[model samples]
Target: MVNSDSPTTPLDSPLARKNPLTMENFHKFEKASNGTTDSMTAPSATISSTSFNSASLECASKETSTIQNETLKKRRNSAGHKKDYNQTLFENIDYLGCSKLNDPSNEPEMLDLMRVLDEQRMTSAVTVSLAVPHSARGFVVLRDTTGIELTSFPVQRIRFCVRGRLDSAQKHCFSISFTHHGINGEQTHQCHVFRSAQPEMAGRALYCFSQAFSNSGKENMSDNEKRIDYKFEAYLEIRENEGSQSSPHWVLCPQQNNTLKLRRDRQKRLIVQLKQVQLCKVFGPPLTVTKCFGMLLAAGRNLRHSDMQLLELESMGPGANPSVYVINAIWDPRIHVFDVLNTETPRDSRVFLTVAADVIIAEAGEPIRFRLEAKARVFHRDERFYKLPRVALREGYSLTLEV
Candidate 1:
């Protein structure tokens, strides 16, 4: 047991009086300077008091001043979080998304995509990681699962071929063929393919990338830079004869029979041409022609599936029937024909014609005119066209339009 009435140490003497480390006294310099005058305010325990060292008191005062300065700084910056200067550039921005293919049997690679809108251009960057083995001579293998060569560019001079299709193996995938220019003026082409689970998002991705690329060069240009402001409009009227009120008539031009010849050029490329028409309507045969409201054009390379070709064309609402229909042309693999089918059922009509032929569009007139042979076949959904009769024509064909 300890004695209750013993003399205290120097630490106990300081605790009996006011503590100098308290924030009230530490906040004011005058309280520490006038310590002798304020000593009377302290507890009257001088009978058993021990003196504190002058050097220790001075060191304590310096530490209190340093802590107070830090507290003042904290109060001044209470608005928001401070930016981290130690972080890298990529870490500073928000990461958008990435696309990768990791089949061990195939060429394994990953593509990290990043996008940002700057004052001048919309910038897109891709970081690629390849898992190819290096040879004894220190050359990395550059091959892909699809047997296409894979190459890359450091920063600039990258020309890309971006394609979005719903009928790909991954269903809604982007095939980006990147052409990288070498330092010696030689070009190397590499392809990176990625698929998105959200199929419609593939089109959105292409739109964003196109918008960014278009704005890259003309950031500083003004709207007033245009040299001309041109505008014009026109109308047309098709007149009918007095005796032809009971039956429907072919608008603008009459129906006539024509032939399509499919042949190959010297390079073995497909060349599809149509035979000329007489441009007259005859009344004897009572030829059945349904007024088709719209036409869709599509193209495909794979012939395994019948509906795969339709995936190439984005849906266009029913068009005005027999009006001159125009379709955009595709550059790759080249398209030769456009098929016009009667999607309507017999509950709607009977013996409707399905035409497959090449059309020459005349855009110079008031209303457009699609010039082609009027000959077409009566299509049946249940009936297979494994063979064509002497008078019957082939059915079901379309082509994809170019961007």
Candidate 2:
């Protein structure tokens, strides 16, 4: 139950086991002689050094392998029976609203969790409750059926996902992880492991958390500010008048497998990506105009650069592919602007977090100007123009960009 992104690798915990001949010590350590000798070159025991070393290696290998096999077997068999701290944490939570695992055995242990939270809540006024968007507040349970109140945290603080698959693998168990912020601002990560066979319960619990997060999005804008959602429809409307004789184009490199393909839609598109673009961060600053839609998603915006954990997932699409619209991107090779190169990613283990950006032609309010300010004058003024839509900016909203 250590507070960390990844816990002990699955089935690696030191649990009680039934071994036939229990040695005084479960592990063997080969020590170097009383000097600076190599660890492998242990003192010659009885026979030739070479024979003795080989025998030791074989014996050690057998011992370690046997232990690993038995440990894994025991852990897999006692899935729901291990009543460790993680199990207690999982069994006691009042997720979103409803109780998660209301086992009778949990009645006694709930006191410890509540006492710890009560102490923390008394630390200072700030510690009384989690500071999240207004929609996600007041989730703590001071008293419950278990005769003890459970500590609550905003659903926005969690990074999690559930299996959308309808297979045996959907065990109604998903991981809930969060970084515990200590009293003095220290950080410790924790991921709760689910062992109970409550597939339906687990799915519903995850849904509640995700739904709460979905409602408390980043677009919680102020009275004067505006948030815009973009739909990149222009991807399908590159060229409508061209006939069937004109085919899509491809630019392939001579040796490498790198290739770029472009396709045009037969209908008209009102919005597409603009060649002039800027990159913005989620937690860094305030933006005057449209924020990356990913900033509005909990998992996307909460992912910290310092965190190393990754959630491996497969897209539910036919081939788990990136969006087909990326093929319609217009990039300037001369300026090093590039498009997303859709490649064959049969197995990528890195967590695939996305921030969906839409291209919009901002037609009003000074055209959202941007430029490079440099002491060294530009050698070439390679300026480019963007043809924005004819529509005027909304009456109360303004388009803005940061460079």
Candidate 3:
């Protein structure tokens, strides 16, 4: 790198012609000058012929200093902008559901139905839940504030891009473009721009959506690693909705499959008795009983323990059996207990889960035991996973996501 603070030699000067202007030659010049310009001011009789033009040297020195000052100012501004960009991104971490399946943070992480600005058309405000089954794709269910299901669809494709400023009133912004496939085989294209009080939240959401496109089983797995299998037992209970004062809560049961069949209380909640969970290693998606049930179960458990707070699942399409609703969990809030948010990365490093399955009530009173297994390889929350995007030129300055 060039040091603009250093003086430059005149092109016609003998010193500039005799030696290359490398750091070593520059240091020699400094040493020969006795580390001071005092000699340049000495009487002409005392001045040596070996010295170059003193007037030219002084001009060059002034010019160098001015350049150095400008460079320093640019660097400072760039740093400030980068800091704001990162802050904007992390401020919305909870809304994006960026938690890894094995994360352990307990901070409430939920996607605020009101905060999402869908600009294509305005409809009555409704709450929505997102989920990811073993397929690793998005499954979204929209509901009213009262929790009545409105509509559900799968996100087929998504594109994330940065936009340029068009006028003095505009700034560089991030955008998310996605296509949602409805139950009737219809597709809807949606685009949302994030440049509000907290734009990083939109970026975080984009990162999570992109994870669905990554290789399902190969993205996290390294070659030569052996798959491990394990099992455990747990119980489930339905907390019936009573009244506004009675908040629903889960009831823990003891003993795995103790002849406790699945039953629904007055609120239409199904309580299951699951036990003897085991791990399974396979190549296909985890939507079936034999494939990725273990991974899906692990993800569900992780949601409770991780940093994410919102939960959603895929619902049956119109005219489908309302009696048996196939609920497939998608982008739920989860925290990676083993790691903290990679706020330093140029782009946020949120883990996307690849396993998904249906919450089906096959038999009212069947014994439930989950075999803990992952269809995809376990993802390591290490430094190598961090991502850094390239800087882009905007107006007069360059914008970068990293410092």
Q: Which one is best on lDDT?
A: 3
Model 3 CA deviation exceeding 4 Å by range: 1-136, 141-150, 159-175, 178-197, 215-228, 231-403
- Residue 27 lDDT in model 3? 31
Clashes of 2: 3
What's the lDDT for all of these models? 0.23, 0.24, 0.25
**In model 1, what is the error at residue 320, expressed in angstroms?**
59
Error of 1 at 101 (Å): 18
Order of candidate numbers by TM-score, starting with the best: 2, 3, 1
State in Å the error of residue 129, model 2: 20
For model 1, the stretches where C-alpha displacement exceeds 4 angstroms are 1-156, 217-403
Sorted on lDDT, highest at the top, how do the candidates line up? 3, 2, 1
Indicate whether candidate 1 or candidate 2 has the larger TM-score.
2
Candidates' TM-scores? 0.18, 0.22, 0.21
Tell me the lDDT of model 3 at 239.
27
So what's the TM-score on candidate 2? 0.22
Cα error of candidate 2 at position 115, Å: 29
List, residue by residue over 1-403, the lDDT tens digit for candidate 3.
1112223212223453565433234234423423121101110011111121110000000111111111222423443212111111122111110111110111111011112222211331122332321222333333334554333323222322222122312122233333323334343322323332333333333344334334233222322233322232322332223333367443221112121111122121222222223244422112222211211333222344233332333232212422212222322112342222111222222222222232332221232323221111122222121232211111111111110
Backbone clash numbers for all candidates listed: 7, 3, 36
